[model samples]
Target: MTDDYILVLYYSRHGATAEMARHIARGVEMHGVEARLRTVPAVSADCEALSDSIPAQGAPYASLDDLKNCAGLALGSPTRFGNMAAPLKYFLDGTSNLWLTGSLVGKPAGVFTSTASLHGGQESTLLSMLLPLLHHGMLVAGLPYSESALVETHGGGTPYGASHHAGADGKRALDEHEITLCRALGQRLATIALKLGNDRGPNR
Candidate 1:
């Protein structure tokens, strides 16, 4: 009974990751679960720099309550030198409070990422996002070989998570395979989340 929703939280620098999030949300809704899309503000070099309470465009900034109450999670980020982007990491780092309270324990979670180059650490970036979720005691769900797009995709798709290659110019749109995988990931996570039912834990 925790809200019947999966929180799709992410940070996109060049829009590729945001597009992936949209596809994933569609998949989540396909499974009859609400997909709550939220994003983090960009990190700034100036310590005092601040963004408007409402962003100029795109999803609203995520609050701790968003992650805490979700039935599931789909975390996405752009690759930052084989890791998750700083903005997403910064947001996750603040969730220690939730971790201590077991807020996310027993929830289903998955990761996705977009990269500017082929072989630019899509898998590594996805794995990097997974670490924090693991620490939160959430159940990690990943795409399997059963997803044909994973094998057929020359651009971006993986067993770990959905991904996209934005090319060196950061403008390549997600191909059909990548979009399929993204939707598949969302659908898979939503399916698991519905079956999970509010973190009440096993019937015991």
Candidate 2:
């Protein structure tokens, strides 16, 4: 079995979602677990388009092994018309092998997102990301009301998951509340993953 680690996987266009991923990773580590950060390459209109073997910068491209071995997952995306971006959707679409093997069953998972506006479908985007995780039989984790940021955030924070309002130009940094909620979600997932791992034994 792979070492205990929560996979922090995401695609960021304007950098907000990536930043949120970083914060979430920190929270995961704070709970005494490793956080493996990975990302998917953007898709293109060309049917034969291909990216280089490795990304130019940022996190490494995720492989099926990464997903198969993770103890938990944190999925993030920049909202595209109230949905996850095509690249992430495309990556999940290719995980049929893992699903067929029941690799992700019972693992905890969470979602996060960033949008250009306060009402730019953050909840819908979060819900859309959760669909595949649910299909894989993963336990879905969401930010609870106990995280005060969910109730107090003026910028972006949701019970559905962590979120940030990136502003019209996509430059607004994550506000304090948003950051707190992001970390809270990550910590929650990690804690649950650890408990589940303990219950299942080291070989799981």
Task: Give RMSD to native, each candidate.
Answer: 2.1, 1.8
Tens digits of per-residue lDDT for model 2, 18-108: 9999999999998889999999988877842266779888999999999988899999999999999989999999999988888888899
Candidate 1 per-residue lDDT, tens place, 77-188, comes to: 9999999998899899899999888888888899999998899999999999999999998889999999988889999998999999999989999999999999999999
Candidate 1 Cα errors over 4 Å, as ranges: 48-50, 198-204
Number of the predicted model whose lDDT against the real structure is largest: 2
Local error of candidate 2 at residue 97 (angstroms): 0.9
Q: lDDT of model 2 at residue 122?
A: 97
Supply the global lDDT for candidate 2.
0.91
- Local distance difference test values of all predictions, in order: 0.90, 0.91
